[model samples]
Target: MLTKMGKKGSSCIIFSIMLISSFFSISISSEQMIDDYRGFSDSNNSFANFTSAGSSTVAISGEPAHVGDEMIASILVSNVGSNNGVANLIIENLEDGISHSGSPVEISPGSSREVKAPITSQEQGSVSYRWWISSNGSHVNASLSGEFSVEVLPRQTISTYLESYDWSPSEGLVLDASLFLSSGASRPLLLDIFISKDDGPLNHLQEYTIEMDPGRRNLQIFLGNPSADSVFVELSPIEWSPNPTSLNYSTLTVNSPSADPSLLDIECTVSSLEPTSGESVRMKVNLTNNDNFQSPSGKLRIVLSSDQSILAESVIPPINPGVSVSYEMVIQSWPDSEIVQLEIIWSSEESSSSVFLSVQSSVRDDGFALPFDISSALLGALSGIVIVLTGRLVWRATSSRTPSTSESGIRKTRIEREEHSANVQTREIDCPFCEQRLSIPAEHDGNARCPSCSMQFNVAKMGETTSSIDEKPEAIENEIPMSFSTDDILECPGCDQTLRVPIEKRPVQSRCPVCKLEFLAEKG
Candidate 1:
């Protein structure tokens, strides 16, 4: 019974000691847990703080985005806390007209990640953004925000012009450009100017970046010593960044300077406006230089084209300034119903000019005379002479039948009778050119010209006239063979005018009626 009581006391004492030790361990663990939570709550701001180097990395592309323009905002985030988990990033407070989107990030401990969001605007105003980061899946608030600008600037436009349409090598080209912007605020812009020759590769002429304000901006640029057949200029904006969709451009053409505009004048005329088949097409061109002091000389070339094919050409005599010269060229002859183009080009070593003439075709089935035929034309002219002779004979027969009514009438009748008698006795001759008969009036007895042909001849031959028919027949028979032959056709060297020299008057010095210049005529 004593042993049993001792064992029970020992077991009771061990149980009591174990229970006291367990109570103290529970109290210590509870205090440690409370202190850890207090520390986490107190340092929440410091736990989510970004590093100083990374804080300045809130960069935005397209600093000044216009309305309807898209902008991008980029940032770098680091897990400053010593915990690694998925982080929930929420962006808010963007303007009503601006919107953005991004994805949640999984950040490692003490590491960083880049976040990008696309922002687009639909209205004009200041734009702002606010971002919140939840670290380690905790909902404690950690935030960052930024703001930018958006505007509705006026529509940008550009235009250009030239000083003169015609230019010379000595006189360069002047180009003027205008830029317009109606916005009150100043804006920066870029421009590129290009120039080329003969539709070749374009070369840089000028580049500019300017601040455009309200109203218009004018710029002038001159191109000197341009040595090419053609020049073209273009101006446009360089949109390196996201910019306004309103783009503008200007284009200009500068042809090679051909001639001095003040000194050169050209005129062209077609010989036959209504041309026919199987005949040469003739064109006359006159070139004149009005400059009094400067004497210019160059070659004149003429090119005729039909159906896009060149037909014939002509070379003009060299001309000088203040001097006028004319040239005739037989370009081409084709059946009617074809369009003809005559291009006359006058060029020197440093100057040139081009002129074009177009003629409409008019050909008939039955051909007509070659423009100037005096033979058939004279028949219609003889009808008037015949009518005049018939009226004179009727007047004489009526006057002889009726008695004179007054003294003036009787005097006129006597004069008419005497004139009629003399006309009947006088002789008539045939014209060599038109072959029309002309009567020689007694009043004009010296070197007389046939009114029908305008050919000058002497009627007084040693006091003997055509009334001596017996002797005149012998003289006429001998002289008829020397009147017409192939030697009569002659061209004047000075003015290119055709002249007819009677075969009897061969080996003679004659004065050209067209040019009035003298030249010796010899039998061919």
Candidate 2:
């Protein structure tokens, strides 16, 4: 019993010591959890305590805060904490039509820094914005926020003009301009001047920087000598007061001196100023040289000015000093009235002379009028009648003198009969030696010589075939000569007149002189 009681007591003591150690460990764990929560609360308190030196102030500098004016907003930030901090500015709630620009910065404790942001607005009114400055330290984070407002003014009105301009051979071109401002400006303005010669490209002449009070102001500019027939000047604004509405530009133009007059004189005359339509117009032109020393040669042109058509042109002959020349031209008049120009041009001397003529409208007369001269027409009719009568008389005299029997006519008939008889007795043949065609009497049958080849060959008789020839000779048939006495007579079939023909010229054609009728006088 003593041994058992001692073992039980030792076990109970060991178990009691284990329970106390467990209680101590649980107490230490609860204390550590409380300390951790306190440390977190202290960190949050540090952030809440961060503050600006005296509520960061904002100021606008440079030009006045007007619409289209670029003004700077200087934000003064002071760090009053005990440690250094990094500060970043954020724009939070900016109104419409307003803009700003800036970046982050680092600040030290007890030192103030100015952060500048450029602000501009395209509208006029109360413009407002909210800004926040976030600062970060080694052990804490801090932030400061505020709101700012400014009144933006409206834009100004302006006008400009080019008053006058002058030019000289030695001084070049000088321009005068005027400017009018409706109200005062807070900044300087820039103006540019440009000039163009003879419708050419614009050239920069001068520039002006203006700083003036409200109202009109005058300015003068000088441009060096430029060779041109005409000068054009313009005034353009480069930069002016903020958003000012004004004219774009003003301009002025000036012309150079006139050229000298020509030394040629022209005189022209027209036949009829108001002629009928479709009628021809006659013009006489006379040109004279007015210069006593120069002899000029060129071209003379007549131009229809309404349509610029060249009606007539001629080369002008050289004219001596103080000499004159004349020309005549005829042209069809236009269907309507118009002005025409006559020009004389000399290319060598570069001189010209011109004169204008006005052609009046066509005139019509509603009456009976003769198109030709009355006396000349009567004389022409009389002359035609006399010529016709003379021709008739000559023809009657010639017909009455024709002879009843003409010896020459009989002789001509006899000769024609002989030629016909000769032709009838001949026949064409080809030479065997040279194949040349020849005409010979049909009765001749012997050796014949070829005229072209000078060679002799036998001729074949009529109606006979030759050994050397491939074709038979042509035959003459029904040909017989007639014989008659010297007292033979024949009656003409046309007029019944008796004609005596010679006996040797038998079967001849004989003509009767009474009716000019011909008939054959044969032996039968």
Best by TM-score, which number? 2
Candidate 1: list runs displaced more than 4 Å. Answer: 6-11, 31-65, 68-171, 228-232, 238-247, 259-524
Provide the clashing-pair count of each candidate structure. 1, 1
lDDT of 2 by residue, 85-119 (tens): 66655553375634354666666766877766667
Error of 2 at 297 (Å): 22
- Error at 135, model 2, angstroms: 3.6
Q: Mind sharing the TM-score for model 1?
A: 0.37
lDDT of each: 0.55, 0.60
Candidate 1 lDDT over 1-524, as tens digits, reads 43676988888877888999999999999999999999988766344433312764356676465555556666677666655545443445455533455666666667777766666555556656665444454333234444544453323344333323444344566566666654444556666666775578878766777766656777766665354434443334344222354335556665543446447677888788766655777778888866432223465655543322233445544354467788876755544554556666665655656688777766566656567665466545555645675687677545433232233543456788777665554556655445577765444444444465444444453346534322321111111112122544466657765555544677765545545445666665
Q: Which pairs clash inside model 2?
A: 404-513
Highest lDDT against the true fold, candidate: 2
lDDT, residue 489, candidate 2? 39
